[model samples]
Target: MIEYVARSGPPEAMNCPAFICDTCRNQVVAEGIVTWATTIGRDGDRGPHQQTPVYVAHKGRCGRGLELWIEQHYPAADGWIDLWDDLEDFVCQLTHNLTNAFADDTEGTYHPHRLVHPKERR
Candidate 1:
């Protein structure tokens, strides 16, 4: 099971809420976490403001527990065409997308994490 712990930054900064997983209970900082930022429109006088949301998973026996959790939660379709045969690849891709979303200046939306089914790309 996954447990969630809320985190916050200084009040001065517009830091969004961050979540920590307690299932695995690891000391690593942001080891298995996803953080994204988006802009919210303000009043006509004020410009849009940025909002960030962070998610972190607890450390499990192995570092790949997050991958396993995702797989279990979102099972692959039968005969799916997976770009990667190992869980590490999935984890890498997820982290890469998350990083990109966090750094994205215009679009801060997170890319969906999913496997391509057979012939689905065409």
Candidate 2:
């Protein structure tokens, strides 16, 4: 299982890459709250539903499209959970034509931590 921990920086001594936001096309730094998921999506226009994007984005304006996408597809759900988007080439698309996403603004809600390398946690 691919497990993930939400943190802004890599473990001590070494550096891990940061994910560039698909919406803003900017670096999702510490002050910015990010969310991602490896969810199911379409292949194309009316295409077969395939496991699609790792939704990496901030919780507000940059994530508007994803919010709408979820509401149209899964209305019963109360909110969305974000996931990693470390992939160099992200395939899935987030549509913004629908209504706005009432995403619970996640900024400043959680503490962003520095991931401790497993070996370094002695």
Candidate 3:
């Protein structure tokens, strides 16, 4: 995630054109895969919900396009790059009112997502 942000420079990720693919470290030019991950809250107090989306190419494979087709359906939880396709909504569900995104998604298909678009890039 940090790598993507550091490399990709951004105003925000939500509805943006694309994000970095963790596997290939390139821009996901169009629709890509989304998964989940698990992380221990920073303060060990459930961290007040998860943060940020990590991106990767779909099926362990890379993709190509004009790099301006898919508008981000969600925002990076903390504002940086995108790996989470639905990060904004996911974070909201989890942090808002102390709700949980797929039960904190700590278990099953966890990545806080396979949906961090699966893991934080770099």
Candidate No. with top lDDT = 2
From the highest lDDT down, the ranking of the candidates is 2, 3, 1
Per-residue lDDT over 34-105 for candidate 3, one digit per residue giving the tens place of the 0 to 100 score: 443333343354333443343345433342221111123233343323234343454355467475455566
Please, what is the whole-model Cα lDDT of each candidate in the order they appear? 0.38, 0.40, 0.39
Give me the displacement of residue 116 in model 2, in angstroms. Answer: 32
Best by TM-score: 2
Better of 2 and 3 by TM-score: 2
Clash totals, every prediction: 0, 5, 19
Model 3: lDDT equals 0.39
Error of 3 at 97 (Å): 14
Model 1, residue 77: distance off in Å is 1.1
Candidate 2 local lDDT, 1-122, one digit each (tens): 12233455545444445656556666665434333332223232232222223445555676676545534443324222334442322322223313434354455232222332223322
What is the TM-score (0 to 1) of candidate 2?
A: 0.30
Which regions of candidate 2 fall more than 4 Å away from where they truly are?
1-16, 31-50, 69-122
Better of 1 and 3 by TM-score: 1
Instruction: State, as a TM-score between 0 and 1, how close model 1 is to the true structure.
Output: 0.27
The TM-score between candidate 3 and the true structure equals: 0.26
